[model samples]
Target chain A: MITLFGVGCLVFLVVCALVVARTRDLLAATVVFAAYSLVMALVWQQLQSPDVAITEAALGAGITSLLFLLAIGRTRRTEDEEG
Target chain B: MRHVPALLLLLMVAYVLFLTMAEAPAFGVVDVPSRNLVVDRYLDPDPEETGVPNAVARIIFDYRAHDTLGEATVLFVAVGAAAAVLVGRPGPFATRPVTGTDDPILRTVARLVIPFVQVYAVYVITHGHVSPGGGFAGGTILGGSFVLYLFVFGPGRAARKLSPARGEMVEGLTALWYILVGLGGLLLGASFLANAAAGFPLGVPGKLLSGGAIWLIGLGIGLKVAATVANLFLHLAGES
Candidate 1:
């Protein structure tokens, strides 16, 4: 049962990662990346490492996304043109 | 066609991970090589020797202190680089500030919740020997609280409490404090970061002030992380 649940989560995580990579909208990608980190935190919790899980949740998901948003707010929201 | 190599790389990574996972010992097996004598040493004799009940804290701040010092230094350097780059060049962000939304709901909620978060952060750092939290976690939460304050009260008001220059000094000092604590061991006739062997009085096990240099190390790390995160965000947001 746990394996099934974990597999389901992994599948969802892969989809989220793909979306983040493929999407051109910077803000949308940032939001999806945050969701990916949340799933990663859950995976760490399932692996029984609460320390890493907490760090992943707080820094990886919360603070990192916030930082990206701050940077985005300062800079451009759209992707630049390729030469 | 464009993603062919990337897809192949991903497959290779998955294969490597599977191979690694296969090498791990079966779950619930205590006799595995991964569960070596070092684990036993920490579980049995280390607590008695160090008087730190939390094995993670002891491992990080006592047994492997040089690594912790390195980690703190890395954080310090990262913050310095961030501030230098962000603050040195004042771009469009400086002209028209992006943050500080005067939403009363955010202000009211942040005003109510920030104190508890900051207090809890302190508790986590102080009680690291008895709980799951440590300097890193506590410091991040503390930093988060500061960010909340910036969102609620705006950078103009927040600067009154802690200016960016002062934050740089604090973070640099905390990094130095870690080195000084390690050097204290040298003063005690032992190597750097020598916990019990360096004559540090390990108070009663599981006590708040116990764990000798571990708590002190945690304190330095906690403060350093807090200062770094606070300054990094402020600088990135063009407030500093």
Candidate 2:
């Protein structure tokens, strides 16, 4: 059962990574990246590393996401199209 | 196509990484080389040796405290570099406060949630020795609350609560406190950051005060990290 859950988490993580990579809108990618961090935190917890899970949730998902949002607020929201 | 060679290179790198992963230790296996005697030495010695039930905390705060100190120094230097870069760079919104969101619901929710978030951060820091959290996790949460406040209420009000000068003072003081705690071990005829081996009181395990210098060092790190993180956000947001 736990293995199934871990597999699900891993799948979700891969999906998030792919979405973040494909998204050209900086804001959308940041949000997807935050989701990736949150799911990664759950994976850490499943691996019995709650210390890492807590840090990942707080720093990875929360703080980094906020930082990205703030940076986005300052800069352009979309990636520039290549010539 | 222009991208064909790039794709082939990517596939080649991926195959190499896959081979490397196959050669690595299996997931969660007990007989893995990573699960060496070091793990046993960290866990087998009861709380008497380390003064904490949480083996993670014991390892970080007691056994390998010097590394943690280095980590703290790195955080301090990173924040300093950020402050150096951001401060006095006259962007239009650099000095003054960026007006906060005027949304009533967001403001109301922030008012309601900030206190709980801060309280939980304190809990994570204080209870680090007994639980899964430690200074880093808790300190980030604490800074996160301040960041949320800055988001909802604007830098003007947030700075009034914790001005940049005050934040610098707190950061420096907490860092000095960590060094002082480490020096205590040396003063008491032991190596730097030594806990029970330094002849300090370990107290009863499972208690809040059980870990001798571990709890103290954790507290210092918590405050220092909190200050550093908050200051970083404030600087990056053009307030500091």
Candidate 3:
């Protein structure tokens, strides 16, 4: 049962990663990347490794996403050059 | 054309990972190699030998202290590099206003929440021997609180309490403190980072002061992590 859930999560995350890679809007990508990190944290939690799960949730999801969001906030939202 | 090798490399890496996972002990297995050796000793650790109850914290702070020290050093260097890279910019470092920050909701929320978060960080660091919390987790939380403070209160107020300079100093001192604790072991004719044998008192188990050098090391690590991460934020976020 847990294996099924784990497989489902991995599949979802791979798709999320691909979407983030393909997305042109840098801000949207950053937000999606944060969500990806959060789900990854959830996977760790499901594995019963609370130590690793907490670290991932705090650092990966919380701080990393915020940093990316802040950086994107200060820069262009999209990759397109406006002439 | 160029994508083929990258694709092939990805497949190769995936195969290696798959094989490794396949060989791993089945989840929830009680008879795994990991649960075989040294697990019993840690489970029933002699209080006279070591006061710490939690095997996770005890192992890291006692058996594998050098690794933790190395990790702390790495974090220090990483934060230092980030600060140097970000703060090297003259305009961002200088002209950014250091004060007069007031977003009403953020300010109120941060003011209400930061103290509790900081208290929890301290609790996690100190209670490591009895719980899932430890130096790394606690320190991260401590640093995170400061980051939250920076976002709401701005650099000026945060700097007043813990500037990048102060952070560097704390990290340096804590790193040195870990070394000093290691040296204490040598002083007692024991190996570096020696726990009870280093003459550190092993009080009765479950007490706040019971873990001897483990708790001390955790304290040092917690302070260093907090400082390093907060300093990292100050540097990266316009250093106001």
For each candidate, the DockQ is 0.53, 0.60, 0.36
TM-score of candidate 1 on Cα atoms, chains taken together: 0.88
Provide the TM-score for each candidate, comma-separated: 0.88, 0.96, 0.84
Using lDDT as the yardstick, the better of models 2 and 3 is 2
Write one digit per residue (lDDT tens) for candidate 1, span B100-152: 87788988898899999899889987887767778998888888888778766
lDDT of 3 by residue, B59-96 (tens): 78887888988888899889877876777675533443
Error of 3 at B223 (Å): 0.7
Docking tier of model 1: it is: medium
Interface RMSD of each: 1.8, 3.0, 3.7
Q: What are the RMSDs of all candidates, in order?
A: 2.7, 1.9, 3.6
Check candidate 3 and list the clashing pairs. Answer: none
Worst-scoring 10-residue span by lDDT in model 1 chain B: B90-99
Give model 2's DockQ, 2 decimals: 0.60
Fnat per predicted structure, each in turn: 0.46, 0.64, 0.26
Which residue runs does candidate 3 get wrong by more than 4 Å? A1-15, A79-83, B1-5, B31-49, B91-102
Which residue runs of candidate 2 sit more than 4 Å off their true CA positions?
B91-97
